[model samples]
Target: MKTYFRLLSFAKPIEKFAIPYVILTLLAVVFNTLQLALLAPLLTTLFASGSANATILTKPAGWADVTGYLNYFSQQISFTYGPFGALKFVCGVIVIAVILGNVFRYFAQRIMEDFRIHTLLNLRKSVFNNVMDQHVGYFSNQRKGDIIAKIASDVGAVQFSVTGTLQVVFKEPLQLTAYVFMLFSISFKLTIFALLVIPISAFVISKIVKRLKEQATMAQHMFGLMISYLDEALSGIKIIKSFNATEAIKDKFDSENVRYSDLGRKMARRQQLSGPVSESLSVAMVTTIVLYGGSLILNHQSDLTGPEFVTYIALFSRIMQPAKALTNSFSGIHTGLAAGERVLELIDQKPEITDAPDAVSITSFNHSIRLENLSFSYPGRTVLKDINLTIPKGKTIALVGPSGGGKSTLMDLIPRFTEVESGRVTIDGTDVRKLKMESLWSLIGVVNQESMLFNDTIFNNIAFGLPDATQEQVEHAARIANAHDFILQTEHGYQSNIGDRGMKLSGGQKQRICIARAVLKNPPIMMLDEATSALDTESEKLVQEALNNLMKNRTSLVIAHRLSTIQSADMIVVLEDGQINEQGTHLELLQRNGLYKRLIDMQTFND
Candidate 1:
């Protein structure tokens, strides 16, 4: 219930929809019940079954005497307007009742539809926004596809379940109560017999759907797992084929598919079974009412006339429809609540990385960024321990290290992508934590090993997050990164759509385009994570030139795999097993014959 209410809160200003929906639905319910209630009086008035020559009746004195007033008015209409005139009037009334009932129902449906869309918009936006704000470590521990499933499919299910439940919750009960009132007005004894079904039906239906919430929760998780499998299969298709593991991958996905399908089948069985089981119980109760009421009529023990008895049976049978609907709604709410819990889990998540309450935004980069008494860890294992370093303004410093040496982790700390576990990373003199993340990230340009390009045009990709960047500015940056000539030679040049992650471009082409993007941002501080290490010799030379252009006179920290690339770096820090092993100018490290020298010697030997 708490999770449901939290998800519901996303539907803000709900009263706007609530107020009008209540009015329309209530009116709809009234007309619907009135339409059915008129059936009895209309029969008595038109057929003249018992009261063909009955006395010309007067209006009843009170509203509480519904049947008395109905009979009186029917007789009055019959005597004054003739039987045929009364017949026409009853027919016209039934038609009007139905039309008005349908009209109000339509308007209510329209409002609920709008309400559904509005809730979907707000809920999806909140979930996606919270996801985008999480720390880098969060994604590392989560499956991208699971997150996508929660945001897309889970939220979609929750929307329908919630809105449908809201529609049913308000509308169904009023309808049931209205029917019950009419039945009691006609025959209080019969109404009591019919009312007993409420609890019995509720108990039986409760047993059927008792485990629905748990099943629904499992169904949602299975869906997420299947989606994750699908995503991995699609993203790693090339690897699967190259490794000759296509069958293995297919079987893996097929297994999850089977599990999800089986679970869905089971859930569907339970859900579909509820409606029938409830309906059967309702029919059984209706049968019992008929037998008992017929005995009373035969024994001449009741005042219910033939027409009124028929009307009572009609109203009693109709009661089951709403009762059945309410039980079905309970089933739907279970599915919705299950999905809602997953969505709330996401919404309830607080970002581990966020700016301070009084954090200031930096405008310019002037001095150095220092890491003081720095240490970083991830649950039971330390990545960087007691590391202290300074990157001076306008100097190119390279970090050369073996795998798992925390090079990327160190770079991430600068942009506040991950929180500082124990140390202070200060820009100029202000702690990075004491500055707004937007301002901190704005001053740094990053180019990673993987070219993170969106599925958009070249110009748009280059100008991403800088919506106001002009073509002239983009082309200039491309030129500086040595990407302009190749770009213009393409199908649409800067206007050309780069396929997903720039798949249309060659390795060197993609790398240069990435460099162009960094150049376009043109931040004062740059973090280059072996941006040139993945390319062939020809692409390497081209990308290296672009990287040089991007790094010129900028405060740069680089992680280099190839020893030659950082031979000219102002300082090269060597890290081994989460500690700084060496730091100095490139030549000084070579002269020392230490870890840096050993790395350079090994790379040279491999070359």
Candidate 2:
């Protein structure tokens, strides 16, 4: 119950609708109770041997106190006849009350539905926006499917908690309470005996609910894992087929599927038990009440007559249905609370990086970029140490080194993807940490070895970074990157939709499209990290040409694994074991006969 209340707090923003919804719910509860309670009068009159058309004043014996109150309200509001008016009046009141109940219920449900969808939509947007603001390293450690599950499945669970649980919580309890109160008014001693079973049944239900909640939480987590497995397997289908690991992957998936199914079945079994257990207990209590109340009528110790006893029994039976429903709803609330906890866990996570209060935007770059004795470590090991370098404005600097020599880490530092432990990175004259992240990133463009494209049209992909770019500007940028020719040859040309991650296009084509996107941005600085390493010789030539065109006048920082690519670089910085080992032009480094010369010789030998 505490967990449910906590989950409900997430809907606080939609609290303005709560009052109206509660009012309508109360009205529905009243009318629904009246509809059931109306049966008592018709039964009483027919059983009492009075004229079927007896009026309210002429037949005080037939009219229960509650029924008389209802009759008075109905006659005051509308038409009323004399002795035979009660029947018509009761029937008419029931019809109008039912209509009003349903109408209020309809509007109340609409308000709740809208509020639930709106609140969940806002929560999803907030989670996505927070993820986008995080440093790149945050995603590097996360699975794509897991993140997607958090956004889609987990957030959806919260919506169910808000809307579905709210319906049961508000409606069922009000109905149950109204019925119980009516029972109390008719026969207090009998109602007391009937009420005794409630707490005992509730205690048993509570024990089952504790276990059910634990299983439900486990089931949702397993579902997430299953989704992630399917996502991973589908994304790597080509690789799996090439490796002939289909059966193995299938076996793994089947195992996970079985576990997920078994857990779900267990949860279902627990939930299924709740309904029957509640119903069975309710039947026992109703039977006991009939026997006990029948004895009272026979002994003439109660004020009620034969017809009144029958009416009371009929009204008391109505309580069981709603009582049963309340128990079922309680179980649902428990499961929903478990699901909401998962979603709120993600929403509560604090991002590793964010804009500072004093952060300001930098509109232009006038000075050089400086790395002052920078040092960085990951987890337990240092990756960069005492690395000092100066990148002058309007000049190109290339980082060339063996794998794991911290060349990529050096480029990562410029963007503060991983914070430095002992030094600072300054862009122009201001520390990058002091500048607003948006302004810092706005000035830089990065082109990685693998191009990332969404499932959208070619034009949209090229214009991704610059959303407001005109068609002509996109086309011109595509032309500059050598992507225009192939795009035009496609079925819809630039308007053609690319498949997921641009999987429909060849590697070279995707790379060219990525280059066009970077070209469209036209940032002041560029980071080319092994940008042509994945291409074949011919594609490499084309991409390298496009890259050269893009980097012509920009302050470019290139990290290259292939020695040939950086042969004509203006300056090359050689890194080995987290520190600079050599710095010179290609020919100048080769003349030094050191680490750079050794690397060139090794490449020459491989060729």
Candidate 3:
């Protein structure tokens, strides 16, 4: 119930839809019950067969005796205008009642449909926005497919279930109550005996669907895993094909697919069973009522006339429909609640990294960025230890290291992408944590080896976040990164689509596009992580020249495995085994003949 209400809160100002729906539904129920209530009077008039001397009924005292009022008024019409006239009158009333009932029902459904859509819009938007606000590190520890499922599939299930059940909760019980009241008016004894089906259906259906919630939870989880497998396979299709592991990937995905299918079958079987059980109970109650009510009529022990008795049976049978709906909705609620739990779990997650209460937005970078006593760990392994480094403004500092040497981790700290474990990173003199993330990020630019580009036009990709960038500005940035010539050579020039992740471009072209994006941002600080290591000599030379243009008079941190790339850096910091192995100007480090020299020598020998 707690989870259910939390999901519902997304449908705020619910009264805007609820109050009107309630009024319309009430009117619909009243007229719908009238359509059936008039049955007894219509049947009574038909049996009279135009007899002017038909027995006149006493005027009913109050509305509570609804059948009495109907019978009295209908017989009065027969006496005044003959049976044919009453037939016309009763039939006309029934038609009007049906039309009004149907009209109210249609409008009521419209309101509920609007409510459902409103809730869905708010719920999905909230889920997506919250997911986007999470820190970058949060994604590293979670599966992309699992998050996708929660936002897409689970949220979809939650909206239908929560809103559908709410509809049933308000409308079904009131409908059932109206049916019961009419039955009692026709014959009190028969109504009591017939009402037993409600409890019976509830008890039997409860037992059948007792495990539905648990199965539904497992099914949602399995579906997420299957989606995860599918995502991994699609993203790594190249690797799978290269290694001849296509069949292996297919088998892994299929295994989870089969489990999800089997569980779905089980859940469907259980859900389908509830309907039949409730229907059978309804039939049994009707049969029992006929036997009991017939005995009362034949023995002359009841006030139910022949038409009234027939109407009593009609009303009793329909009562079960709402009861059946209630049971089916209960089954659906189990599944909905299961999905709701997962979605709420996501919404409830607080981002691990957030700005402090006194955080200020710093719009400029000056002096230097300093890391003091900075140590970090991931679970059981340490990634960086006591890493102290200072990067002064307008100076290019390069970090040269082997793999897993904390180069990337140290770079991430400047932007506060990852929280420090033991120490702090300060910009100028203020702690990075004291600065708003957006303000800090606005002053730094990053280009990684992967060259992350979206599937959009080159102009849009270059101006990704800067939506208002002009064409001239983009061209200038592209020229500086050596991307303008090739961009214009494409079929559409600057407007050409880059395909997925810029796959339409070559290695050098893609890197140049990424560099152009950094150049457009034109931040005071630049962080390039192995920007040229993946390129050929010709492409590397072009990218290196662009990098030099990008880093001119800017505070820069460059991480490179190619010794030739960072030799001209103002200072070179060597990191190994999560510690700074050495630090000096590139030429000074070469004079020491230490780790930096050994790396340079090894690269030269390989060349």
Best candidate per lDDT, number? 3
Model 1 per-residue lDDT tens digits across residues 19-51: 999999999998898887788778787558455
> Model 1 segments beyond 4 Å from truth?
49-58
lDDT tens digits, residues 26-79, model 2? Answer: 988888777766665545434433555534433235444675454344434333
* Clash pairs for candidate 2: none
After superposition, the stretches of candidate 2 with alpha carbons farther than 4 Å from their true spots are: 1-6, 48-64, 68-85
Please write out the lDDT profile of model 3 over residues 462-548, one tens digit for every residue: 998578999999999999999999999999999999898888999899999999999999999999999998999999999999999
Residue 301, candidate 2: Cα error in Å is: 2.1
C-alpha RMSD of each candidate structure in angstroms: 1.5, 3.0, 1.4
What lDDT would each prediction earn against the true structure? 0.88, 0.80, 0.91
Clash number for candidate 3:
0
Q: What is the Å distance of residue 363 in model 1 from its true position?
A: 1.0
Q: Clash pairs of candidate 1?
A: none
Which residue runs does candidate 3 get wrong by more than 4 Å?
Answer: 50-53
